[model samples]
Target: MTEDLTGKRALVTGAASGIGAATARWLAAHGVTALVLVDLDGPGLAALDMPCEVLPFPGDVTDEALWDRIEAEAGPLDYAVINAGIAGGAPIATMTLDEWRATLSVNLDGAFLALRCATRLVRDHGAMVLTASVSGLKAEPGTAAYGASKAGLMQLGRVAAKELAPRGVRVNCIAPGGVDTPIWDQTPFFQEMIAQAGGDRAAAMAALSGAATPLARFATADQIAAQIGFLLSDAAGTITGTSLVSDGGYLL
Candidate 1:
């Protein structure tokens, strides 16, 4: 059956780019009436020309005060996609305490804050999706901080799903593998890795995708967003407390 979002109100964090931005556009295409988009990139948010009523909120998702303002002004939300996150980290031996904390603050803590507020504000039967990573499920060298943060987010989603089930608010996590998103370009570790590969980021990405992913390619942000859109729709009403792995068989 086809999914429809006509006249529905939704909230999307990290909507300035990547999966969040794609999800917002997908929702608009599906006929959502109002979109409350939150992102730290003010200029990026302003550049988005969605067809719906766009309430662009430029702020940190980790800020409790920001969420308060969002809840007060955005009105009742029918869906939420908590996709704001940072990537890149060092090995445990080289990683500093501050680096670890910073990763957790944005990935785990930010997710917790968004989930807390979403549970309170989302109408009954509404759904939410958290952006996690394949690293959360499988270990990789030099990703101690990033992996731990996403793993925590995975557990958090499961627990929140159970707690919110009575209220009919479904909570699920989306763990994606390497996607050609701006986040990769902004990640220091990834940039350094690419530099090591003859300074060709595309070549490095292709090599990595060929070696690691069974599908031999990276998933697109819109592909991941499509899954997020599904979880938020009535078509996935029976799905909750589950982790949807869209990793092109990276975990396998």
Candidate 2:
């Protein structure tokens, strides 16, 4: 929609579907020429047919080595979207160590690894955005692991922004509330939450939408992706080290 990234090189992780996919498509539509998409979903990324130049690199964002390989594969990057994340729901007492670690590894550590590598290749006039959640700043008893990781991600963005600002590399984050995404299918906690809450699954998911939202609806993946696209562009040149909420005003 916005022709701000016409000559930029960008990378988007967790880009198979949902917000990541929306972001990649939007960037391409906006004229970003060099687009590097990273995901474990090789089939999905390979299947995408878009207008921009895309290099789909399949790997785990949590793996430190993946960043190195992406660099060797995609040349210099102008923007990086750290969009991979995990959700682990349960009382803290009953949560498994593996579950807890996986949440932090992908949401927090994965973001760090991406930004660390991106900062190296990002032109002096570059930017990076990480995907956080409304849970990052809200209170959710059952989502201890997920919330903690997301909260830490906001802090990571702040620190990275401070560390990278001097170099003209802007670092920021986007926190969305509940958006329609396949991530729900990947998590076991949704079913448990539905059962625990004693409500219809469709009703529950709809209830999370902007029923009381100031904006009157849940955010579409394209909506969040648009914000990400803006941040990566020169439009957000003065924006850095901040967690921009795209939750349709659930926090309000």
Candidate 3:
């Protein structure tokens, strides 16, 4: 049975696109009445046409003032998806201090801010899902900054879960391997790969996913969104402080 979220309200970071946007649409389709969508992409936020009430907040997640404004204005929420993040990668030796700090600022510190605000605004029995990445769990040469940040987020989710348990709130992480998301477009490596494939992004994605993933394909944003929805639902009431890795067997 599909869990109904009628009259529910939610906060979705990174909601302008990819998994965040998909989750927002999924929640609306499942009967959520309202959503407060946060993202750095103002145009992207404005472009979304969800069935429910959508309050789009455009700003950087790393900005504490932005989150503070949200807490003051968005009011109560039943669910929170702390999914705003960026893609950054470089070998430890070559990666600049600026690069390292940038990744941590958005993926880890930004999550902290969002979680803090959500804990204040979200009701007891509410749930939160952080969008961590498989890079955090399994190390790669160039992924130090990205991996460390996501690793921190995973730990943050666990700690938050423990701390919020007494209040009947649950926290979890979704560590996706490589679902096709616009976040990839931000990386120069992927852009070069696309160029190699004669600008066919799908071909580039297929080549990469086919090589690394046992499933031979990357997941779609909608697929990941469904998982997030399940995690936020009553069906996942007993699950907390854990990560649901949706990597298409890439870890293997």
Q: Write the residue-wise lDDT of candidate 3 on 59-130 in tens digits.
A: 999999999999999989999999999998888999999999999999999999999999999998999999
Q: Give the per-residue lDDT digits (tens) of candidate 2, residues 1-252.
A: 445667888989998888999999988888889889988788989988879888988888888888888877788888889898766687888989988888888888888888788878887868899999989899877788899889999998899899888889998899998777777756676666567658576665665563647776777789899989888877788999998888777888
Top TM-score prediction, candidate number: 3
Clashes of each: 0, 0, 0
Better of 2 and 3 by lDDT: 3
Superposed model 2: Cα runs more than 4 Å off: 192-204, 210-216
Clash-forming residue pairs, model 3: none
Question: Of models 2 and 3, which has the larger TM-score?
Answer: 3
Q: How displaced is residue 96 in candidate 1, in Å?
A: 0.7
For each candidate, the alpha-carbon lDDT, in order, equals: 0.90, 0.84, 0.94
Judged by lDDT against the true structure, how good is candidate 1?
Answer: 0.90
Among all windows of 10 consecutive residues in model 1, the one with the lowest summed lDDT is 184-193
Tell me the alpha-carbon RMSD of every candidate: 1.4, 2.5, 0.8
TM-score of 3: 0.98
lDDT value for model 2: 0.84
Per-candidate TM-scores read 0.96, 0.91, 0.98
